[model samples]
Target chain A: MVTESDTGSIQVEIIPSRFLLPATAQKLLNEIYGNGGIIRIMIHGPNLPRSVPYGPGRGSPIDENRDLLIEVGGQAFELSVKVGRIRLELESEKYYEGLKAACERALPISFQIRRGKFFHTRQTITDYAKYGKVEDTRILGLIDPKAKQDRLAILSEENVAVHDEER
Target chain B: MAYTPQYYPGSTSVGINRRKHMSGNLEKLRDIPEADVVAVMGHRAPGADYSSTHPPLKEMGEPDCPIRQIVAPTAGAAAGDRVRYSQWTDSMYFAPSIPYWRSYWGAINCKGCDPGTLSGRQIIEARERDIEAYTKAQYDSEMTDVALCSMRGCTVHGHSLRLEENGMQFDMLARTEMGSDGNVYAVKDQVGIPLDRKINLGKPMSEAEAKKRTTIFRVDGIPMCGKVGARKYDEAVDALHHMWELRSKWGFRPE
Candidate 1:
């Protein structure tokens, strides 16, 4: 979800457990911010809570989906993504391939992919101001940069073994 | 260290590894007039404490540039040998504590001779001074800040008519001179390239004395020592206008 404050401040949250995959969340973030600004990602799980900030500078506490606030030129922006089965409030927007490239730059591979699947696979994103919306929904699938080549190969290789399973 | 391969299109590597070949190319650049801007470049020599880093080169033309390059002597180069350098090492490199090798490029400056006879150092310095004066004249007249384009064709915003405040700043007030002819002529004194702004003269010039008549025009308020051509004043005016527009867009301080 994206929310803009009165002071030109912005807040975005993406929960992976609530989505099909992390890639879904990534796709949504990429669609909003084109470029010209920096994006920082903080990963928090079972054990790592309020841990040290990743990357260059030191001395900071960050938690998972708690809130990572970024301020630029006196304005603030925050992003938090929740995990596990979620009913996306916004309509699922069609995923763009370039979105994958953008995600690769910001969040790590694992979280980015999970977010992408969760958001793009299940939600419905609509233009509130304009009813004539852009259709961006795509087939249910996972697009992970790290697993792209291997996953495509696995899918193409006559999946005779998995076909035998009777669910 | 292992010998790395160096590649140059249609050019022989002189059978040396990448490091040596790079040094050779850098040497050749020192000789090219266009490459005179490369005052320093080199690979880190083995065990030679090569931690120094040269900052990105400033685009050539600007008024009152923090960086200046003249064919100045290197610590090792002979008195006649010249190298390009900034006015201050600290402003050029983010960190200047580390030691590094040096190189020189560009023309030399020689005073005393008429403007037309100048080619090497004298010509380069004259051009720089003339350009600076031109910008200053415009600033003084328009009462605004102007942009100064570097010799490298990069434009820097922020140049003003007001004198800069430095404890030891010299006065370079603008003035007008009238000679035998009755018309008033504007003139400015020349400022030498700073100690850090040194570049070596790439090619030697024939020191021939030519019988040439020259005129002078003041640019901005800075005094320039040069023989002005028929259209030199117009050219100076155009340069100032271009810089003026640029500085305005870049939010330069007029002060």
Candidate 2:
């Protein structure tokens, strides 16, 4: 807060309040993380499969192209985007408001935003614990993207490095 | 007694198209060369011999039956050409030749043909040369829009999917690709095997042209409910309703 400056000149301030759709969000993310590595963006919506399910060409391969090969910040990132509901396990409630708003701008229907306990705030009795899981279901994917146990393996599998540079 | 044939009922553009398709009155849109049609069918090379499944009926010397004597075999059967099929997939986005409509066209127009209709695709199986001729007729007719309808024997995925930016229907196997010269080129056969050279199928129909020619009663287009003679209370619907009611009532009666 710029309360009282020594010069006491007419102080001007700017606030970033523009709502972002998927296209705009993509640009914003690219600009913010342009210098290096990867800023994780988990896109959730209508999960369209990359293959045909029925008819004469049943089980035939298709290029759904939902798995986007986006070249952001001059670095190509293959975002394995899925469409679904997200249960936020956020430390701050304010961040959840922004996440909900972002979802609204993209998908206006079939999405419910509510405060709930879902993903673990603290890692314990994990789906896939330090070594491995007792029963790792295939539906949840072979490796959970959120799990910390196979953090390094997940990064390598997705071909992305953690964005750890100072702002 | 002489009989008059009325194809389909309705005063709407869509109904009119259905009538045109069924009556074999669809205007010729393009003339794909016989060689090009063969190339797309991928059954046999252009000018190649038509492989046979059996000897010609005359050569085999069939047993003298009154029925066989009266019913002359088609040219294809007479030549002993093997039975072959042509399958087509029409996109739901105002494609002219819907599955059922395609089958109707083939069943009524093509002789010695067996038409099978699926949800998104339709196939017509006949003697090899006969099928090729039938397929070529459909390809050249207004029933097929190069972008909206495609000959896809298998792996047909674009029936309900969004069209590509170039206005071509989505082909999972990339059977067709749009050329820089504004012509749609078929690079692969119906089953998706790469061809030796591209077959230029010509330009896609304009949005206006497709909407006018489409037989599909879409909400944005000439919806069936809003059409002048095809409305719910229209004679076509009323006739169908009356027939259904009578059929059910008569089922329980001896008369």
Could you say which candidate leads in lDDT?
Answer: 2
- Please give, for residues B102-219, the per-residue lDDT of candidate 1 as tens digits: 1111111222112211111111222222323322221122111111111111111111111111101111111112223332222211211111223332221111100010011223
Q: Using DockQ, give the best candidate's number.
A: 2
DockQ of each: 0.00, 0.08
| B1-255: candidate 2 lDDT, tens digit per residue | 898577777677888888889999889989999999998888888899999999998899999899988988889999999999999999888888788999999999989999998888899999999999999999999999998889987776678765654567766666787799989898777876667898999988998999888888887887764464632643445556778999889859565
DockQ of 2: 0.08
> Model 1, clash count?
81
The true-versus-predicted C-alpha distance at residue B220 of model 2, in Å, is 2.2
Predicted candidate 1 versus true structure: per-residue lDDT over A1-167, tens digit per residue: 98633332122233331222234333434443453221222222122124333321122333222454533233344423222222222222233334445545544323333332232434222221121222332211222222221222121222322221232
Evaluated at residue A105, the lDDT of candidate 2 is 53
For each candidate, what TM-score against the reference?
A: 0.15, 0.68
